[model samples]
Target chain A: MEILKKLKILADSAKYDVSCSSSGSKRTNQPGGLGNSASSGICHTWTADGRCISLLKILQSNNCVYNCSYCVNRVSNDLPRATLTPDELCELTINFYRRNYIEGLFLSTAIYSSPDHTMEMLLQTVKKLREEHNFHGYIHLKAIPGADNLLIEAAGKYVDRMSVNIELPSERGLRLLAPQKKREAIIKPMTFLTSNIAARKAERRKSRKAPSFVPAGQTTQLIVGATPDPDLQILKLSENMYKRFGLKRVYYSAYVPVSHHPHLPDISSPPLLREHRIYQADWLLRFYGFQADELLNEKNPNFTEDYDPKTDWALRNLDYFPVEINRADYEKLLRVPGIGVKSARKILTARRMHSLDFDDLKRIGITMKRAQYFITCKGKYSGQTAMEEHLLRPRLTLSPPKTAGPEQPSLFSFSSDVIAPEDAFSSVTGEI
Target chain B: MLDFVYDGSFNGLLTAIYEIYYRRQVPQQLLSSPGQTPKLFVREERIITDETKAGKVYEAIDTKISSRSLRHIYYAYLSEHMEAGIWIYHYLHLGWKLGNKLDLLLSDERVHRIHRLSQKVSMERHRLLGLLRFQLLRGNIYYAALEPDHNVVELLAPHFAARMAGQNWVIHDVSRDLAAVFNRKEWVATDFTLQHRLELLKEEEYYQQLWQEYYNSMAISSRINPRLQKRCMPQRYWKHLVELS
Candidate 1:
């Protein structure tokens, strides 16, 4: 097949992986290299689906030896399959890099042959891009789970980030969907690289010229809504992974129904809203001071589409409100519903001069509609309703304010009529 | 109300600010122009731009207040908003009065306005760094043309200088008739225009086609959201992107 035809098929096959971030790498161009990684990654463009296209996400080949039911590139699927030669792949990367089409390459593949052979192809292509082509750009290579540890370690030396998709949430799901792939095949490489990355980081910190290995660290993806896995189980696994594996991120790809296998759920569309909630919960665990059990317990096994996880937590824990915005410390302020990390920092900075009122809070970019119920400014509540759960629940769920309420007070007008003192007083009142 | 008319350069704006403090008079406007109308009963004065005075003022801000505040003033000035100069004058005036705690006064309208302007300008610069696409022209030169809302072409040059150090390229800001041309060794800003049509390499069209195909195939059909796409890559920037075209 022509390379153009191969590119379309390969990219279409790879799109289901859905971990296309190019951040957390500060790799600079070598003395004669062509490109570099921005400290805060750059998105070249957004696709029609509104996903950032930061990298040239394509497969080395779509020919597979395994039939994972949730995947589009499974063996039983009768679709056009193609592979790119290393030289062709390198040529496309350099040309695209010159034109600024992508931040770097995100190279994944189906198991074209045995796991060892497929990994060898990935390792060679990356080494060629780094050595012969003099390319110092960001690369995120997928580790063939059952491949040898030596091959995984060698490839880590040349790429910014590497990942092995924990294809299903649990062992039973993996056994039902993809019987050929072993769970140990995935966890073994993850454990190996985590140690290597830490060791290299410590060595580099001690000496300026020590060789670096996977300097951008590692990340992994989980297919949400694929198995009958509760969000509690998924989040607990993620929290454990973050601690045990030292993983950078745990991506959740809402199961897009690609196959009609009996083991898989019969869904018409991807569970996009459910995926979004999982990501929000993921962010809270990583950035905000929240634990998995705190956000979700046995009784509440899933996140609601009505409110975010933080707001849900606040609604359940009523005593936490109404937090005094001026007196709350940074950690306490972060727990409020509408105050994000950025908004929290802004409030702290702006409140140092004087206690902030509702007007100043709005200027500082707090989402007062949601936050007003959870917080108090100068010991005064400003929400549309009182701080009762029943009173505020519907208001929070229905986001828009009243369309035909009393007109917003004009900027020049006071809340109460501010009559002139001369007009209010009887100036010439003298008893006869 | 008093007004000062000076040349529309950053240094000139700084000189007008120096004159604002020299006369101890607060001006209602700082007009840099061939055509600007003053309010009724307002007096106008022409101010010459002095490099020495501008330097002294910049040095004082850098030394006394903070380098970060100085950077904020510079970024805000690049925004080229009509009232940016006057707002910056007020900010710096307050900076001198407040000493080191100037930026922390975010509740003050004048300081907040300047911060917003600086943030806007820097955000545009960051966006253009990613959105600007380079097309390969004849003679082995890479060219990109953009029309940003702010004067941000100069700010993008340093990043590309370190990025594509071995190649020759030009980043042209068609709206303002300016370009940053970088040779293999160094970069320089010069007046630039497209007098006639230019030519591209024979393979340029093929790569552009591949990119468009990749862009289309990457977006899953079930989740197409044009509004979010427009929000991230605004419609104003679609004119130059090959994939979008």
Candidate 2:
């Protein structure tokens, strides 16, 4: 088959895995290297889905041996199969990098023939890209769940990032959908990679010449809405993963129903809003110092679809609010519904000069619409007549209707504009 | 009200700023040569671009303030905002007083304005690093043309130079009529204009088509949000975007 035909099949197959970040690594260009990975990832283009396309996300092959019900390339599914030679993949990456089409490659594959065979092919392609082609570009390779430990370790040296997808959140979910994939197969590699990365870091501290191991660290994706996993369960699992495995990111991909099975949810579309909310709660867990129980619990297992998780948390815990903005510490400021990491830092820096009022808060880039009810600037409340739950709840829940007209100039304006709470929510959370 | 006008260059702006401190008189407005317009009761002073005076101000900024502040000042100059020169003057004045702590005074209007303008310029430069698409021209030279809002071609050169170290490339800021040429070893900026269109390689056209095909195919049809897409990447940048074009 022609290369373009294979790319179409492979890329289309790989589109469901939405972990597109090329960040956290800073690989400089060698004297004769073709590319380098920036510490902060760059999005080369935005797809029609409004998601950033940063990497050449493609699979080595779509041929599968395992029967994962939620996947498009499961052995039971009769999709067209295609695999690229190691040389073909290298040439494609170099050509694309030269044309400035992508930052690097996101190479994934299904279980073709066997896990070891698939991983070896991936290692060969990445090894050739690094050694023969002299490509220093960001490469994100997928670690086959049941692949050899030595193979995974060797491949980790060449790629900037690697991920072993915990496709379903729970062991029960994995057993029901993907019977061949055991929970141990996934967690073992993550544990191994995490320990090895720590060892490499200690080695590098002793000697600067020690080569980096998975410089960007490992990230994993969890398929939301595929199983009957509650938001609380998922968040708890993620929280544990972060504590245990030292994962860089836990991407939440809204499960798109690609295959029809008796056990799977009979929905036509993915639960994108739920995925988005999970990402919001996930961000709070990662950056905003919020725990899983703080965001949601057994009684309230799901996040509200209207207001963000932060707003929901704030509304639930109203007594915490009316906190004096001037006197509040950084942690207290972060609890406000509208202030993010960036604005919180801005407020901290700006407040050192003078006491900040509501106007100054706006200038420092806080979303006053949501934060006003929760904060008092200089012992004065600028919110509505009463900070009652009924009034505030309705006001916060009402998502601003999409503005009609030629695109607003404010949309294209610089970063200092009063960030809409939803915009802040989406910026940190990956787009659908 | 006095107006100090100078040649439209970063050094010229610094020289005007130097004059403001030397003369012990604050100009109501600092204008670039092209921005200057005759007005009643406005005293206009044509400040020459003096490298020595500009160097003094630049070195003082590096000495008193941090090197990061110097970068912010240069970025703010590249922003080409109508009030950028005045803002930079005020920022430098404050920097001289507070030394390195001037950056911490984000609440000060002058400091905030300069910081915001510099942030805008830097953001655009970072965006162009990814958004700028190269088309393979004759002689295996990768060429890209863009019209960024800020004068960021020079800022973008080092990044591309590091990435494409073994390849020849030219990034043309068509609006400014300036090009950054990287010839496999070192990069140089020059005033360049296209006299004739060179025929692109056939493989280049084929690859561009393939890219468009991949881009269209990759998007999930159910979640097509044109508003969000426009917000992330404005239509102004679409003309030169190979897939969108």
Candidate 3:
């Protein structure tokens, strides 16, 4: 197949990096503009793996100069290589946009020659999309770490969200696994983006018409279970990243063993449960007002497979439990097991009208199965057993099998109960 | 049990609700025209779809309850659930006294039922926003065909009209025989039919092929979870999706 026609080859190469979130930017369609970005983002489809196909996530080119060992399109690898021209990229994005196949384009690339050339190619394609095609859709362009700051800066203006992947958590993992990729090379571009994104916001504050730069801010991804790096190390790194730089999200992809390198762990399947736990912890940090240290400490560096990060935190600190549902503030409600941001808000709202009971809690959409142990409605506990770590630990551990199992996922399909509650935000009304 | 029949138009539904109030009769079922006949001996009345009465009820919901409640009632009505009319009646009956607080009483079965049906309809609307696939017709019209759970094709028009302001498009909800046809200036929802399978442009096929190839290659084989995929985009929606075929 011609290099330009090998859409599958480039897409397969680009599929592993999982940062498809298209939210944060609200670029309205200009008069006669071909597209616009929704503030919350619209997920167009779900791929077979169940991951959302929100954007046309593709690479500009897969022929690489640097050989990252974990990557499918490394220099030494013999995979089919292809490059989409700037016009080809625009055409595909516009055609897809017209058909509602995607929210926007998620353009990344392997270092085809130098980082500068590759970044320029990405920048060129996005600029053409905006200028020639009059497209205003969400664009998430990946920043090449070692690329020049000018190219990165130029790319930011045309894109909604930009990301630089810190694939390995620790510098030591970076040294061992990817010899060519220095930790400083990645950090330098990230720091630049962090400052520039901030400066542009300050400018927009002064003048609303000042053109937005990376309106959705920036994001980064870390490969989990790639090395012997503990979950503590991963969480700590994410904590520092969020605090130090105002990044939007830090995605954790369970390292799929693409090749058998001596440095890589000989795991049969990706550690999806660990990834899910880390994501749960990450959510707590971002939305639920929890710190990394609160969830994990040095004494227990790794998350146990027995419980989720929140449940583990609740169990370790039982003193915070038995919070009175009616009187407990929003923060206290959040700390309780199984009370998510939505449910916590629900409890607060329902509490105003009348004091809640266990029955009311259930109606308010609280996950009573897990929450029954931690909370008291009308000062009455509803757990099957008393509120002790030994008693609750057995009950709290997830009974439902992981969505992505350790072995081939098809062997033990998850029951409906496990799947139903997901992203349901099923907490029904209380606009009251 | 009292049964109310009317045209399956939103205005007609509102007119039924208006009659329910003026006649001081509680209805057990609200059936749309050409709808199923009521069982033997059930009191049935066909309501005339009066824009004037509907306008009055629409204004009353906004003034008495909040505009938010108006949205809830409208969305619940669109759900076309069998008992939605009765629930809305119960909701409005209590809402007259409780006003805005009616929704806040989440524990109330009537209020909760209205919210739940509305949620189901809106969720499907959000899904179809992402799932509706537009193909280019031979006449340069961007055409899409879908069978949404609720009548959301009209709802989806403003978004597409803003995004694709330069182009003419038609979003046809095949199940209901309704289509949202948009010219550059404005859009209208009207009765439409396909007559036959749409003749798409040859380039439209090429783009769909490219999209299919891209979609297929995007999934990581190591983490393939058909169950999750099905949950998010169920099998019922796969009929119109080009990538699925």
Candidate with maximal lDDT: 2
DockQ of each: 0.50, 0.55, 0.60
Give the per-residue lDDT of model 2 (tens digit) for B1-245: 88898898889998998898899989988888644346888888899999999999889999999898999899999998888888888898888888888887776788888889999999998889899999998899999999999999999999999999998999999998999999998999999998898679998998887788778878877566676778788899999999998
lDDT of 3 at A304: 69
Question: In model 1, what are the clashing residue pairs, if there are any?
Answer: none
* C-alpha local distance difference test of each model: 0.84, 0.86, 0.84
Tens digits of lDDT, candidate 3, A223-311? 98887888999999999999999899998888887888888877756766667667878888877789999988889988766677788
TM-score (chain A only) for the predictions, listed in order:
0.91, 0.93, 0.92
Better of 2 and 3 by lDDT: 2
| DockQ leader | 3
Q: Where is model 2 chain B poorest over a 10-residue stretch in terms of lDDT?
A: B29-38
Using DockQ, rank the candidates from best to worst.
Answer: 3, 2, 1
Residue B6 lDDT (model 3): 80
The positional error of residue A131 in candidate 2, measured at the CA in angstroms, is 0.3
Which 10-residue window in model 3 chain A sums to the lowest lDDT? A423-432
TM-score for candidate 1, residues paired by index = 0.94
- Worst 10 contiguous positions by lDDT, candidate 1 chain B: B31-40
The TM-score of candidate 3 is 0.95
